[model samples]
Target: MEPIVDTVVIVAICVLGAALARRLGFIAPLVLLVAGLGLSFVPGLPEVHVEPELVLIGILPPLLYVAALQTNLVAFRRALRPILLLAVGLVMFTAFIVGFVVHALLPDVPLAACIAFGAVVAPPDAVSATAIARRIGLPRRVVVILEGESLLNDATALVMVRIAAGALGAAVSFWDIAGQVALKAGVGVLLGLAAAVAAAWLHKRITDPLLDDAVSLLTPFVVVIVAEELHSSSVVAVVVAGLYLGHRIPYLLSATSRLQMDAVWKLITFLLEGVVFLLVGLQLRDLVSHLEADVATTFRVTALVFLTLVAARFLWMYPATYLARLFPRIREREERPPPAVPAVIAWAGMRGVVTLAAALTLPRSANVPGDLFVFVAFAVIVLTLLIHGTTLPMLARGLGVREDTSAEDALAEASVQHAASRAARERLEAAADGAPESVVDRLRALTDSRSNNAWERLGSQAQETPSAAYGRLRREMITAERHVFKIARNEGRISEEVLNRAQRELDLEESQLNRSDD
Candidate 1:
């Protein structure tokens, strides 16, 4: 009972914190972290210990899957080079440098254990970064790079963690680590592709949105579990499966199913991220109490490590951006991004739950001071979140690196809508030969209205457009209709089932109108 009650209270606090952040125009995760930290210092409050398995096995997969699902595959492919540089190459570089520095600072700690700690903090979680980017309308290319890096970096860091752990037990050679990487990558990608293909085939047959969403929800967990059992990178497997399925969803699933699945995933992600960030903050008291080193030394090392991590990312980003242009084909294919772009990318390296979780997973016998490593990781997360989360938007704006693609996006949307409307007109012509003229005309009007609304959105917004006015008026009508329906039901003029069915129709139409306004 106590456990259940605690869970409820925690979730309530997370939700409330997030709501407050939204209202105040602050980053929700950072706000939640600060709130949790304050709560942790309250006298008589129980220490909150977030289990690593709970994070690694339970929270991670779904979050990764959702991020992958939302990522534009085409954009991801275009940014593949930069993504790999940061996700794989920079991770290795940061790990080695941090390992050497940590060994120098704490001579008693094994190099392998130090490297493991480095691996624990190498990958930056893009959840917060992407959120800030989208909110501030940063360039789409930058967002793609951040999202793509996040999808794959976890796999790289986890692989490094495993190698370092092996080294702690026995000397691990470069060739051994290389072989493990190839094996894990090969197995994870293959299994993920197979799982996605099978799931896609199954989902196509399941027309019911609820059942389809059920399968969709289960896919990440299933793929992750199987990949883990097969000694592959579960993170890679889940991400690949999600990307594949998300790409195919438009063709494979019904519109209703897609809508339902999206809403479900968004809700799940919101709750999970909220809980994870707050829990991370609530851990401060326990981590500080369990520190194996003096508090002063622990904080000093943490500060140094945090600076090292920041410096390493900036050091890698510039070279990674400019050096890739050495090849003629590469130079011709990709334009050099402005220096500010790289600066923004480098500074957006905020760590999150994955780093803390990885630190907790470090082997007990790895000759690393477990509490110290955890504390450093926690401090890094806190510092990064607090500093980067607050300053990233300001930096991007100050650097004149913001996106101004509204006109371009509107034009693209209008073009797509015109093409869609033309196709629909052809389909209607082919199938509606036997239909009533009124019905055919109504369908045509709706199609034209949709296309026109999209184009109107591109026009100047000095006053309300016809489509906006229509949507606004129609919404009022829907409200009125709903009121009357309730009155009818209250007067026993209609059955409950009838009222519900009628309301559903109105709700769907109102939703369509609202979407058009966007």
Candidate 2:
């Protein structure tokens, strides 16, 4: 009962924190972190201990799944090279280098333990990077690359962590470890693909929105469980399944199902991400109390590790960006990016909850008397989230790394809408032979309105457009209708069902208007 109460309180805090952050024009995770940190120090408060399994097994999958589902598949394919380099190559490089540095700083700790620590902090959290990137309006390609990298980086980092943990117990050959990683990852991918296909097939048969969403919510958890039983990379399994399902569902599912799925996932994502950040911040108080060493030495080592992590990312980004062009086939296939793009990408490597969770999984035997590695991981997460999260937008602006795609996006949208509207109109005409003339005219008006709305958005920003006027008028009328409906319900002139049906209609209309405004 107490645990249930605590969970509810935490979720409530997340909602309030998010709303407050939006009102103050700041990122929700940042705001929630500060809030939780403050709450942790309240006198007589019980320590908030975040269970490692809760984060690793419970929170992580859904968050990653939602990110995978939202990723732009076309953009992901275009940026696959850079994504792989950052996700796989950079993560391995960071872990390897950071391991040696940590070993040099603390020779008492086993090299394997140091490397495991590095692996814990190697992967950047998808929520933190994308939240900051999207908030600051980074280039779409850059966001896509970050999204793609984040979706897979966890698998690479976790695989390293597992191997490093195993080495702490006994001598493990490099090739043997390599073979294990390959087999595990390969199996995970195969299982994920199969799960996605099977799920999609089942969904095509299930038309009920509630049931479809129930299955969608279960996907990440089911995949993760199956991967775990098979000794495979659960992260990869969930991500691959999410990507395939996200891509396939839109083409096959009904509009209602899609709408419900998006709304459900969005709410789940917002609450989960907010709570994760807050939980991380709350861990700080407990972490500091459990430290085995003096504060000064721990602080120094943490600072060094943090600096090495940052420097390593910048070091990896350049060669990875430019050196690939050495191949003639590659040089001809892809255009060179601006010099500053790499800098922005490097600067955006903020760590978040995943690092802390992975660190917590490290055995007590691995760290000896104290969980120094866990403390350091928490410190890195704090520094990265606070420093990088806050300064990234400023850095992006200073570097002139903003992607100005407004004109191009508008042109593309108008073109697509125009073509789609024309096809819709033609289909309507062909089906209208025996239909009422008034009904056909009404359908034609709605089609033209939608097409015109897209084109009007591309018009000059100075004057009021027809679509704008229609939206504004329609919204005002909706508000009046809503007021009347409420009054009718209050006076018992209408039943609850009728009132709900009327409200849903108004909601659908307003939602359309709201999207057009965006």
Candidate 3:
């Protein structure tokens, strides 16, 4: 296919798949994966050459950057214990368990190759986990743990995979491998922090919102490229930079810059996510061709490997949660520890692009059966995507560990308080004018309607008063404001550009308020 035609086809598939996923109540990435699978069967479809470096460089930096930007660094810091246990400890545990099992089951395969397979499949895909977690209403803490794990574990896994591959290819020592992992991780962290601080400083100095927005758009790529050039982990660099800059973003950029950055990144995230999943599905043919064994043998080996992965997660999570509770810091810090957390974690082990990219990047000349390792990785990805991803919501529901109603209520109350505050401020501003009595009265009524006195009273007395009826009215007022702006622009009372800018600001404010509530 011509380059333009290929681009059009990819865009069409992504848009259609995203829409279909929403309509069918499934995640968009899953739809994209299925779409890619179908497209792979078409005779004239252009081949998607899988590149490992591109996965980390082209895809991961932006996605991780956005995720880091969205992540509440304060919350992450507070939940460090759980996040570390999951991100660092759990990943290592999973990798070792899978590696050991693979080596034991297939004695012919070299130990290093088995470990490589484990490393590739160890970390869960952040994009997939975030999409599903949001849909299923997973607790904020649970989502944080998942997100933190997804961000950092790849660094550890990649380091291990490279070390293992080296040992198999060249007779490297355990001491050398250990030293390299520590050195890489340490340097990567420093590189990431430095990049973040520099970018944030640069952003603060720039006064023009448009210029600042452009800088923010390019910041992640800068961090990733600089870190990788220095032989450090670009994934870690982008994530750290994202977290640091995101934490200081309010102070670093103007309101306009922040608004533009949020809007642009949201669209960018959607596009990258769609492209990653589509490419993942399309790479299956290449993976199949790389396997040395027949389809039946490959299926059997892959099935066993998948079972090992699922079992290991369950085994690890149960003990890990219990152990976490044993610590006073953890127990004191955590909210209600859902009894079904282990099961939820187990079911959430759906693998995606990261694993596929790692597998396909395996060195063709590496000794100890690189092809088998790729096949096993593919098997895990397919199993997790098809079975675990499909059943995760059901699992959460079954465990009674779905959305927490009380927490959501608290979030809603907080939102109502913020809206009430904003309304009061607007009312006070309008009341400053020498308006007529009727207008003043209407303003007062609106202010009273938006008040959160009932919520405050409930907080003090443990009363079960329902949320005030003002939320709907507040939404209506906002909608009316937007409609008025649109009409004014159409009537030439205001320029289209001005109206658009105002509308975007209002929409962003509304979105922020809603997210705060959630």
Q: Scored by CA lDDT, what does every candidate get?
A: 0.90, 0.88, 0.77
- Per-candidate TM equals 0.98, 0.97, 0.83
For model 3, residues 396-488, the per-residue Cα lDDT tens digits are: 788877666564566687677768778786867766687777877777665654455424433643533333234445567789999999899
Worst 10 residues of 3 by lDDT: 463-472
Q: For residues 1-518, could you state the per-residue lDDT of candidate 1 as single tens digits?
A: 99999999999999999999989989899999999999999998899998988998999999999999888888888888999898888888888888878988998888888888888999998588888888998999999999888888889888989888778847755456657766897799999999999999999899899999999999999998899899999988998998999889999999999989989999999999999999999999999889778878887789889999999999999999998899898899889999999999999999999999999988875357888899899999999999999999999999988988989989999999999999999999999978999999999999999899889988999999999899889989999999999999999999999999999999899988878766
> For this target, which candidate reaches the highest TM-score against the unseen true structure?
1
In order of listing, the candidates' clash counts read 0, 0, 0
Give the least accurate 10-residue stretch of model 1, judged by summed lDDT.
Answer: 169-178
Off-target runs (Cα >4 Å) in candidate 1 are: 172-178
Best by lDDT: 1
Give the clashing residue pairs of candidate 1, or none: none
Q: Is candidate 1 or candidate 2 better by TM-score?
A: 1
Rate residue 59 of model 2 by lDDT.
Answer: 95
